[model samples]
Target: MPILQPIGRTLLIFFAAAGRLSMFAANGLSHCVRPPLYFRLIARQMIDIGYYSLPVVGLTAIFTGMVLALQSYTGFARFAAESAIPNVVVISITRELGPVLAGLMVAGRVGAAMAAEIGTMRVTEQIDALDTLATNPFKYLVAPRLIAGITTLPILVFIADIIGVFGGYVVSIYKLGFNPTTYLKNTVDFVQTEDVVSGLVKAAVFGFLITLMGCYHGYNSKGGAQGVGAATTNAVVSASILILCCNYFITEMFFAR
Candidate 1:
């Protein structure tokens, strides 16, 4: 009976949390679609989430491309199949690595910031004050973030894709002594429109999930400062996990036979 009690408690808690998250997502999404959007706030968030994040995302993408090229070379060299490096690099970057890595990086940076800022507001009673002042917190805060996230992530991922592929190009030509013209040709020839589209779609989804998790945690925080801290941590962890899980499912949807 004691063991069963623990299992049942855990299951109940999981379901309760899931329900709350789904409701929050629905409410926030509704606000996003309805009128009275704060476009200035949305643009501000887009700059914060996308422009300020470029350095970290760019560095991560470039280094990832470099490493991927090196590793792909080492593996393909095993069978004298070195000619396949460009194809592998381009397809892999456009389809998987660029968006996933960019998502995770932004999730860590932007997600934590959102949780901390909003959680602080919650603990400080600013959200309630907004309600008292005839303002909708969801419309003012959550919607702007959700809109910015969904719109900006695709652009960020697109830039990351270019930088990553260029990184691979640099390595293949400079370090691996491959002909630049041939490498670019193979990359262009092998990659398809669907691959890029799939990645952008994944980026948009990831952006939404990241902002949603951050806002949900922040909006529901309690216990004062410690609560805000916990919310920030949860926001980043949840966003990152969702990014990886969604990455798998999206890749399967796009590429699986």
Candidate 2:
């Protein structure tokens, strides 16, 4: 009975945490659709999440495509199948690497920032002050971030896809000595609409999850500065984990038999 008690307690804790997170997400999402939406706040968040995030996402995407092309060439050359590099690069970039890498990068940067900002508010009584002033904190803070995250991430992912494919094209033509025209043709012919659409869908889900984790952790934070720091760390880790997990399920849903 004593040993069973510990196991039971752990299970209870896990379920409780999950329940709290779900409720927080539901509450925040509900506010997103309700009246008194803040367009200015949404625009600010969009700039923060999208515009500011471009550099990291772009660098990560371009380098990923370049490395992918180089590695594919190295492997395919062994079988005299170097011609397939363009197809591989395009399909891989549009279908997987672009969305996943961009999501992870944004989760690290934007997610941590959200957590820190909101968590600081939580610790400093600013949220309570908002309540006194007749402002709904969730509606003002969480919804804008959520709306911006969902809307902006897809655009970033699409741009990343283009940049990634172009990186591959550069490597294939300039470094591998492949014919530029032939590489471009293969890339264009091999990629389908389904691949790009699936990637965009994943981006939306990843964005929502990233913001949810950040806001949830921040809103629930306690203690003080230490707690805000912990929330920031948890936000990044949780958002990253959710991105990878959701990516697999999304891919399975789109491509599985």
Candidate 3:
């Protein structure tokens, strides 16, 4: 009975959260269409979320590619498929790993930050103050972050894909003793436009999911500092989970023919 109670409670919370999230999204869409158009806020979010996030995303991408190449090389060598290294590396990075890693990193970094910031605002009565001052909190706070996320994630993923491939290139050539010229040639020839497009699409969806989760949790935060902390944690966890789930569906849609 105790175990069943816990499981039931967990399911209840999940459904409640999902319902709130649906309403939150609908509110956001309505505000987005009827906005006073906060372009300045959107631009600021772009710089903060996109520009400031570049270094971490790039570093993660490079290291991921390098490590993947090393491991894939070791595995492929056993099957005597060494020449396929470039193809595998490029496809793996561009199709799934690059966008997924970028999204996870951004969720950990940007999502938590957004949730904390907004949660703080909520607890401090600052959001209430905004309401008193004739400002729509959704427009002022949510819209810019949502738009910035939609715009920037694809760019980050694109950069990640390139850097990850380059990392693989370096590892294959310098560390693993593969011919640089042939590696580059195979990578270029094997990587298709669809691979890149699929990654970009996934990135955009991930970006939106991350930002939405952050905004939703933070905007609805309760308690005080402890509540804010919980919201931040929830935002990161939810965003990361959603990114992984969405990535699979997107991949299936793109390539599961």
Top-scoring candidate (lDDT)? 1
Alpha-carbon error at 35 in model 2, in Å? 1.7
lDDT measured at residue 1 in model 2 versus the true structure, 0 to 100: 78
Candidate 3 lDDT by residue in tens digits, 108-221: 999999999999999999999999999989989998898889889999899899999999999999999999899999999999999999999999999899999999999989
lDDT of 3: 0.93
By lDDT, is 1 or 3 better?
Answer: 1
lDDT string for model 2 (166-229, tens) is: 9998899899999989998999899999999999999999899999988999998999999999
Error of 2 at 67 (Å): 0.2
C-alpha TM-scores of all predictions: 0.98, 0.98, 0.94
How many clashes show up per model?
0, 0, 0
Candidate with better lDDT, 2 vs 3 = 2
